[model samples]
Target: MRLSDGPVALRPLRMRDAQPWHDLRRENHTWLKPWEATRPVDETPEMSFANMVRRLRAEARAGRTMPFAITWSGTFIGQLTVSGITWGSLCGGHIGYWIDKGHAGRGVMPTAVALATDHALQTMGLHRVEICIRPENANSRRVVEKLGFREEGLRPAYLHIDGEWRDHLVYVITSEEIPGGLLNRWRATHGPLHA
Candidate 1:
């Protein structure tokens, strides 16, 4: 499935995206490394791009994740995934995303996130969506703040990022809080001003 508004879009990541995806990651190594998750030192070797895509596709098919390519003007710019979905009483998921440095600060990430969160809440019938960002990631925090997600609290050593465990700020929004949908709320609050 694809979700879009104007120039920003979120579509399933395809095998064909491997090259562009690798190029973006390679180019943005310094820009993204600080915020990227790191595998445990003793974990198995990383999978190839093709295998990674296959795993992501399998997760999507199993209803455990939605892996999307963040696109702008018909070009792949990054990735956004709503993962760790829980059905029972929890009925919620967490969002994780990254954008190429060239696309930063243009409202692309926020728009992509809004679209994904809306899909999770409206179509998937999820109860809430959460985003955890390192305290140092001001750009990412701004995205959630712009969307009006409430700050829950700090999660000490939440996830291993870069080379060590990092403290993360938890932010969340519930389905009921965005009855009109996240995209609609975003547009109303941050859209172009009318004369």
Candidate 2:
């Protein structure tokens, strides 16, 4: 919730978000289809919003994971979630997100990512965060590179994306990388922010 971007907030998904969520998801269908889990035949675009909210709430209440919807100016813009969490040895989860196509490149994801990452490290007590991206997705690569996530390696034929097996570039940023505070971390990774 404490992101640098004004009016951008993370809130639990709700049934009321159904319509806007459907519209946004349908808008980004082809764009996001490659990266997301396969869609089911029984579901229409309209039903997806309710499904998302239901799933997120169930997961949260079960202590399985945390899911957040990104909203700006009363519109459902996107979603970010931390999944596959492990309590011990790994203490990690994969970070996944997507923004409304119209709002891309607006500094939305970075602030949201930083805020989410801070919550993971400082609040959830997680150690490492992982991001797996298709090698060709330059925008996503920029996000990770800007955030100082080290490129671990490529896993060939790692994920089913866009109806085919695609290689994924694994990236990670540990809690130790943050050093002292958010500003320092941002400066260290992305250089000085211009006034």
Number of the predicted model whose TM-score against the real structure is largest: 1
Off by over 4 Å in 2: 1-5, 39-47, 181-184, 187-195
TM-score of each model, in listed order: 0.96, 0.83
| Native-referenced Cα lDDT, model 1 | 0.92
Which lDDT tens digits does candidate 2 get at residues 8-111? 66677677777777788789998887677543342656345567678777877775677888877656798888877777788887888898988777666766
lDDT of 1 by residue, 10-81 (tens): 998989999999999999999999999997594788788899889988998998999999999889999999
lDDT for 169 in candidate 2 is 98
lDDT scores for all predictions? 0.92, 0.75
| Best of the candidates, lDDT | 1
Per-residue lDDT of 106 in model 1: 80
Compared to the true structure, candidate 1 yields what TM-score? 0.96
Error of 1 at 32 (Å): 0.1
Per-residue lDDT of 84 in model 2: 76
